[model samples]
Target: MNLRQIEIFQAVFAAGTASKAAVLLNLSQPAVSKAVQDLERSIGFALFDRSTGRMVPTAEGELFHREVEQTFAGLSRLRSSAARIRDFGSGEIRLASLSALSTNIVPKAIAAFRQRHPQVAITFQTQMSSTIRDLVAAGQFDIGLTSDEVDATGVTVEPFAIYRAAIALPEGHPLCAKPVLSPPDLHGEAFVALAPEDRTRQKLETVLAAAGAVPRIVLETPYSTTVCAMVQAGIGCGLINPLNAEPFLGRGLTWRPFEPALYFCTLLLTPPGRRGSRIAEDARTLLMSFAGERPALPADLHHVPEG
Candidate 1:
């Protein structure tokens, strides 16, 4: 039978009379009686005994009431879950990001978001820029943070932050004395470079070549954090994003701006056709705020790409 009929049956069974059921259900007595009658017709069975003035449940009615109670209980739970998701963002947010941001910036942003949306669940994955782009484009992730080098074909790319490349150095390094460094200052110095496929690495190589400066390449890595760690260990000085270099600044590591500044651009990526949930948008805004507030980077360098 229909939900309304089941509801009427349940009310009558609980209240023991159509008149009492009508008062409990906020319906007219005739409407309640008619609903019960319709339900009995639909089920091809009498659900109640009317031998006395009071309505009493039949054996079939008692069994049916049990199922109705369970059904309503399940519906109540479903509604509660839906309300939780609506009001508190209790649903999960799937996110992916580049390794550089995943290390510090993203984690800080997630912490801030959790302060506001404590019930929202988060799944964060760190991947290379291209992999982040692919995951977002394939709709596997709700939001993605990646470098501007990502292919924007099936994904929408928005600039989240920009940072000028800097020379990361260990404490007591001779180059730390320079206020602003150019590639020539690094000539013949040991260098920790990013992997060859990294766009920033290619740009650094171009700048170095143009300046006629060749640092002795000693190590190559895919992550800016690793570059910073290697620099802290005095393996070699490296060019890195200022955002990624912030956490290591006071921990026996320092950075200086590279003259004729080379820039590293970070972008937010999302599937082109999908609308992000409120929680996802909120998290993205927080991430942008964290990126904007990086004291190590210039204010003008921070930007949001056009829609």
Candidate 2:
């Protein structure tokens, strides 16, 4: 019999009378009686004893009800699962981000997301921008935060942020005197370079070359966090996304604006045709909230008061 028929039988059985079942089901008494009669005909057995003036369950009907109870138990579980998926997402969110954002902003966004949806599980990975693009395009990751340099051939792309590259330096460094710096200021200075393939690095190098500003290269790294650490360690100075410098600001590292502005463009990547699960999309919204919200730093970052 159909679930509607089974539902009618269940209501009639629970309520103990056709009139009561009609009140419970929001149907008329005659309709409820007809539905119970239809169920008995479909199953080829009477569910209620007709000899009694009041409704009473038959022995066979009681045995059949045990199975109906089990069926509804499973249906209850399905309803709960659907509720979770609709409200908190499909249980998990998988996200990958480039090191530039992963160092500071992405982690903050994730923390906020968790506070809002504590039940949603998150899989967060820090990879190169190109790798993030690849993962998103292949449908291996639900969302990707990457630099605009990655080829968008396989995934849908949108601008997430564009942080102006800043000059990261050790405290008390001489270059700190300038409110804003340009390629000429770094000439012959010790420089910690980003990896050769970095999109921002390529642009900065082009500007440095055109201006004949050749800083003495000290070390090379792919991560902006590492660049900040090296500058803190007195290894050298470098141009990095200021978002990566926030955690290091109080730890002996500082940053200043760079002129002829070089920007670290950030992109949001997702599978082209379809969107990600509810939790993943929720995380994407949180991440976008961090855009352009950098804390204001003092202009004379390197001029720490003698303490």
Candidate 3:
């Protein structure tokens, strides 16, 4: 009938007598008997036969008890899971990030977060920086990692990491001789350029144009990983974020500091009005910590202002 009736019925069935059920449920025997009577009346069935002052369950009562037991078991499990989630942050954390960060930085942060909260689940998605920002603002994701080029109208943005651009070159390349490369040094050199639509690519183009230097553009793609791959294959040298360049090291790829530094800045994005779950906040902290541990670039390198 109702949850209370079902609970009393279950207690009576388990304990075999009204007085014993009352003791188990911390209720009076009269209250337990009245609840069971009301449940039988609501169900229009004789749940138990009273004989010799002992209650014996009818066939219908046994069948109903089976279903009630199953339902109660499910409720018990739900309560346990809810408690676990509330106390230990053991639930799904939805994370969205740019394609570049999804490769190395985000994964490293996830690994660190998992070490502390092994039961917490994670969902990671990769999209353009704008898309990541939009999804986070829409509350579709708990956290977002993107470049500073996003529109921060409906989202809260914090500086997550600052990476200086580096020159990625194939081993034995002539530019490898230079400890730090400037735009003029790369002039006329075959270059693997980022897609024109990329914000970082536009900034880099502006910097090179101001320096009166132009590289012989060989290929263009949207992904930083592809740029690293092309450089390793000797297609051309590339200026890329250091985080993207880290994994390609010692794989026929080497990185040199780029002069007149152009920073590739990443921002942490969250919904403007809502606080994130404990798990999401912990993950954000881990990501920031990982970024901080990366080798610091030169302090004297000139910073390119955000346009």
Best by TM-score: 3
Q: Tens digit of lDDT per residue, candidate 2, span 1-307?
A: 7898889889988989988888998999889888888888989988899677767999989998999999999999889778879886587788999888876778889999989888677898999888888888888888999887789998999999887788998988998777678899999999999999889999999999999999999999988889989999999899888878887886788888888888888899998898577787888889999876864575455432211
- lDDT of candidate 1 over 1-307, digit per residue (tens): 7888888888899899999999999999999999999999999888899999888889998888889999999999889779867864547788898888887788889889889877667899999888888899998898899887778888988888877677888877898777677889989999999989778788988988998999999999989999999998989899898678777777778877777778778899888987777778888788888887543642222332221
Show how many residue pairs clash in every candidate, following the order shown. 0, 0, 0
CA RMSD of all predictions: 5.9, 5.9, 4.5
Model 3 regions lying over 4 Å from their true place: 46-59, 81-91, 295-307
Stretches of candidate 1 exceeding 4 Å from the true structure: 1-22, 27-73, 80-92, 297-307
TM-scores for the candidates? 0.74, 0.72, 0.83
lDDT of 3 by residue, 24-62 (tens): 999999999999999999989988888857778999989
What lDDT would candidate 3 get against the real structure?
0.83
How large an RMSD does model 2 have? 5.9
- Backbone clash total, candidate 2: 0
Sort order, lDDT high to low? 2, 1, 3
Q: For this target, which candidate reaches the highest lDDT against the unseen true structure?
A: 2
Give the alpha-carbon lDDT of every model: 0.83, 0.85, 0.83
